[model samples]
Target: MKTPPDRSGITFEVGAQLEARDRHKNWYTATIEKIDYDKERVLIHYRQWSRRHNEWFQWSSPYLRPLERVSLRRQGLNAPMFVSGSKVMACWTDCRFYPAKILRVNKDDSYTVRFFDGVVRTVKSTKLKPVDEVRT
Candidate 1:
């Protein structure tokens, strides 16, 4: 697996959701308003549906920070590749399906990806072979 690149010139689609952790280590979901990969952080716009207040209030998460990217080496030659915003299927060891977008392609052979539900994760290319070679 390879480490992901410094996330610059990367943009998330509107309405995209992202996962963020607070100082308390509590995880929450927020919508992406803007991104700054060079800074390794993103501005997340969040709102909570308050049943008690019967209204939605605007909120923001602290700059969502990313950890260092890592990579894994594969035995075979490189296969066809996909670009940012390309929709692809990711299979994890847990036998679950994660639909994600390519966020950054690292020099070390890892990909920083954003899942459909808006969680940013780094996956090794060795672990994530493309399901289809044909580009959509």
Candidate 2:
């Protein structure tokens, strides 16, 4: 049996939920299977139900962010600015702002947003802006 590696500031523990960037810079969730301290990366097993052969695929991490469990941080001075299910605008990598809904509030104060087109993305609070709904 192999011993689990010591936890580092950037390295996550086994079974920790996280999101990592793909080749196209899209983020996807995965679980930490192993940690490589020497290489400063982690082995993540991402589940893909669409795949037939490789249902749980492993990927290395340096581009991974630990999933947040708390909604607010910073000692009550920095509570999350937005709540889940809130309508907001999110900034994409292309620098364009698109309408999205906050799916969840992360411990890091970021949010998982779903765009109008059904694309989901985890973005920082700074990249979000409140939207004023216009009743029809």
Best by TM-score: 2
Model 1 residue runs over 4 Å out of place are 1-80, 129-136
In model 1, where is the ten-residue run with the lowest total lDDT?
Answer: 66-75
lDDT of 2 by residue, 28-116 (tens): 66666666655555566664623332122222335665544321242333678998989998999899899999999887667999999
List TM-scores for all candidates, in order: 0.35, 0.42
Q: After superposition, how far is residue 99 of candidate 1 from its true place, in Å?
A: 0.6
* Alpha-carbon lDDT of model 2: 0.67
Candidate 2 local lDDT, residue 127:
98
In the order shown, the candidates' Cα RMSDs to the true structure are 16.5, 10.6
Question: Model 2 residue 100 lDDT?
Answer: 96
Q: By TM-score, how accurate is candidate 1?
A: 0.35
Report lDDT (CA) for all predictions. 0.52, 0.67
TM-score for candidate 2: 0.42
List ranges where model 2 is wrong by over 4 Å. 1-77, 134-136
Determine the C-alpha RMSD for candidate 2 after optimal superposition of all C-alphas.
10.6
- List, residue by residue over 75-132, the lDDT tens digit for candidate 1: 2234437666677776565767677778987655667888788988887765564557
